[model samples]
Target: MFSEERRQEIYTIIREQKKVKVAQLAEKFSVTLETIRSDLKYLEGEGLIKRCHGGAILGKQEIKKISKFSDSFDISCLLHDLLIVRERKDRKPEGKVCVLGSFVVDIIANVDSFPKVGELINSKSNSIGPGGKGTNQAMAASFSDAKVHLITKVGEDHFSKYAYKYLQESGIDSFTIFQTEIEPTGSSISYLADKTQNNITATYLGANNTFSEQEIDISLPYVSEADVLLLQGEINIEANIKAAMFAKSVNKIIVLNVAPYSEDLKQLYATLDFITLNANQASHWADIEINDINDATQAINVISGDENKKVIIYMDELGVVYFDGRATFHIPPMPSLRVDTMAATDAFNGAFASKIAAGGTMHESVLFASAFLSAFIEQKGVTAMPVLSQVQARLKSRLEDIRPQIICNEKRCI
Candidate 1:
């Protein structure tokens, strides 16, 4: 058998038995002792198993322990401590998700070159469509075959009408969208330089940033109903924090996609079940310069803060780095001709949440998200989320691997 297959078999054995001797593996696989040792070494190196003198043991996931001094009155953290002791409902990884985030209409303008300050310039092309980190992420999860319920706000205007129309047909299982008459619908101006394809977006908070405790309380049912709650930095921090605290109370998995780097989220959001962010956000969060893997590692370690945190860092068009407290793995970029890079982060975040909800291991979820990303980016807009076949094809051709098709809601997947 190939080495990869052999290693996988050995890994299974160690996982089932919790320990295995080198000699036993060699005899079982009809391989030499050296081969068995090599397999054990590789598995240990991959953090799947722990090598010992004459055998290996399955690696244990070291969950960070909540301090005893933590107040019992702090019900959320107290409940979370209890949560780790019980069996979670979403073991199949195909569970429901609730996204407490924002949706904005994106106005993208392309230019030959960035104009000088205050100098008027003409655009080569322009387009308007549905785009927002939250909207994109929820769509990705829906496309990944997860049943998603999005909780957000929009203005009571023409844009709001489009928002309602879009979500009504967007395949997201449900949405608790609030229409505020005071503020205009959330919107952004994106300038894309022709040469570099680089972009700068300025967003008007509008109704997106007006979430209140009352609204969050109203959305509590969706928060409690979902197996996983996905959050981002784009929404109102106070409201999202309350939503998160509620999710924690009910033992839901919390995943934060930190973007637009906010100082308030640095300490609190990092403690979530999964925290995924791009390199720029990581640099700001960890207060470290991240130019390469080593630099990224330092930033991850700093953000991890000596806990067994599941932290992932993405460098656009470069690759994804996942640090699981103990070790870090570098997942290579999914090769694709970059089109609109606007929603890549949201795509990955949403896909990752779906896979995690489906009970895939962190590595497997990363692989799945990586494949989804390659498929998502080849297209131009967030609404251009590829179907299962397209993602499966990307998994076959681009990622060079295939797994069971993720199916949910009778017609969606990752």
Candidate 2:
């Protein structure tokens, strides 16, 4: 029974001041400590805040949005019209995604409940799917019609072959898919329940941990050639920083998706073009309390700053919070049925990058990504990503549906 309005107000206060005690919050809101705890629990669940020993801190995300529009498109007078024209053919970018991070085969089981520790519960259906933050991000970029160059390691095993061939067939580059024989390829074990809550696992490193700085040096050339480099935290932290610096040196846009909450990501923030994350990762890394959805903006601004950096906070069904230098956009989720929550952010980043690469502004890119992701979530897995034309079609259809409701008032009709 936590009110979003109350949660957001308290969260905003804490974020502004950097700390808020239970007494302060309760005194300000006239609520008991127990009620405040419930609010904290809800915020914690959304990945927006952390409950410290006593008070709370701003989440790790500095959500900043950048203004990428030209003078013609930057005017607030044109925003409504802008949404309609976003699907125009002028905004498609084609290059390739140089993905840097881990790759693994995801094994998902749909089950009713966990068996006793010593026993087993059978599943209604199971799947051997392509995933891992890096791979998923690569697939997401590919689905946006960008050529993808994946830099990862997998065991020289059957799963590696399957993953490689799938990437190849789907048109992702495999030049950097190095192999190792020391252990099996990494795989994630997941158990999905009827409520959509699930348990997941990652095997200890496996071949993915084998990637070294030397290997990153070898791939620096590719990073230079690509328009953008997408990175995930699952890789060795040092290697990731090295690659980010290299890409930045060449003026390549670096987009980071920091997951798994590695303590080693201290320097990753200052070097990114955009950092997308769930609420908790933002809270954990940025030291913010995200008690409500709107409070996400405060967390985001803390991580990236009120400067030119762009930080996208993907809050799942709550939609996305984008902070650019000029403004903040709280775009609600496009109504759609979500089959699986995995890989959606990757799809968002891929499409967003494609829009930027194609010379669209940040606003345009986010809108495209939002709509594209809506489509992906409606289907299941990475295979749901559509080609550029299909994405446009969906946008067109959605916009057309809303156009009639917007009366032009004669003066602005044209």
Candidate 3:
């Protein structure tokens, strides 16, 4: 056997037994005593084991035993135990995610309906908050327990404070968030109809347009370190293209969310591992009118032909359709009370990207993302986004409800 494989076996033995003698390993592997000693030395150097008196033991630091305590035990012992637990949790490995997008302030107003060209109307309510496809998606990924790095541009204005504070509180690394002195921060004005829950939006690409290829190049280190990179259409198209190319160079998985329908994204499909879009955006990209799942399937086939590209089309209320070149499947939506649907797509993309970064398969990620959005839309705004635990709980409940169908399907296949 190869030395590396033998060493791995030796490490496993040491871990399982907590200690192992050199003679025993040499005899078990049919190797010389010198070879066993070398393997043990290598493992010890790599911190997988510790050598002592012709034997080796597991490398993990020994935990101290707590003494017997009475009812009047000191509080410091409890604190020490809590500290140890926290340290162990913190030292565990975690996945890294990089998000490239825009950070815009959303000025939302509730209106009765669309006004005529020369008509005037009064809004029921108005509120402003931090938004933008990039910021929202980054926040979503962070809430899903991934270490997220958000790359975007904002102006050195008052609006930028919201981005800073939000990212800091969300535990997202914003070191790549460039600040422009000339351009103002991006802003979006939306009018939401109270009855139908449909809305129209207008965005001012202020600082969002300022991110150039140079800025994208500066973020190459973060992109290279990420297991998965997420891009959206809110930033400059050239910068997005550069980001995609850089990620591809480093063999990082790329998940692109084509929002607001950009014609430039047609050239990017071949470079992306997965492309997510709403029904209208997919219809436009595929040059077909997608009225339902059948139309979406046709569109997916048109867009993903010949290339190994995957596509996800969000069909409102119906569900989401996924096409992975070889097969097509529909993920049913989880039912929930709809309060605000503005951030639904962002929530889905973020959770999906998080799952991908955490090494989940495409189907698993989509299921988790669907459950996350179901829990997200039940709340009011961006502040109401659900965490990873809440989403997992909801997904568990959903799976339990569908267990019977799963069992039946398995039996039929068998």
Q: Which number leads on lDDT?
A: 3
lDDT of 1 by residue, 232-320 (tens): 98887888788888888889999998877898775455338888889999999889888987677777777666555778898776588
Which digits, one per residue and each the tens of the lDDT, describe model 2 over residues 1-414?
A: 114335655556755687678777887665789878887776555444667877677556422211321121222212231011112243343665688877788888877765567996789888888777787777667667666677877787788767655654554533356666776678887776646644455545677777767668867878887888888877778888999998888888888887867767757766788887778888887688776665777776676664457777877767777666555666767767767656677788777776666667776777788888888877765566666677778777775332212112221121
Q: Per-residue lDDT for 232-326 in model 3, tens only?
A: 99888889888899899889999999897989877787679999999999989889998887787778777665674887888878778886545
> What order do you get sorting by TM-score, best first?
3, 1, 2
Error of 3 at 409 (Å): 16
Q: Clash pairs of candidate 3? A: none
Off by over 4 Å in 2: 1-93, 112-120, 197-203, 306-308, 399-414
Clashes of each: 6, 27, 0
lDDT-wise, the better of 2 and 3 is: 3
TM-score of each: 0.72, 0.69, 0.73
Q: What is the lDDT of residue 319 in candidate 2?
A: 71
Report the C-alpha displacement of residue 284, candidate 1, in angstroms. Answer: 0.5
Which pairs clash in model 1? 92-358, 93-357, 93-358, 93-359, 94-358, 144-413
Relative to the true structure, candidate 2 has a C-alpha RMSD (angstroms) of: 23.7
Looking at model 2, residue 271 earns an lDDT score of 76
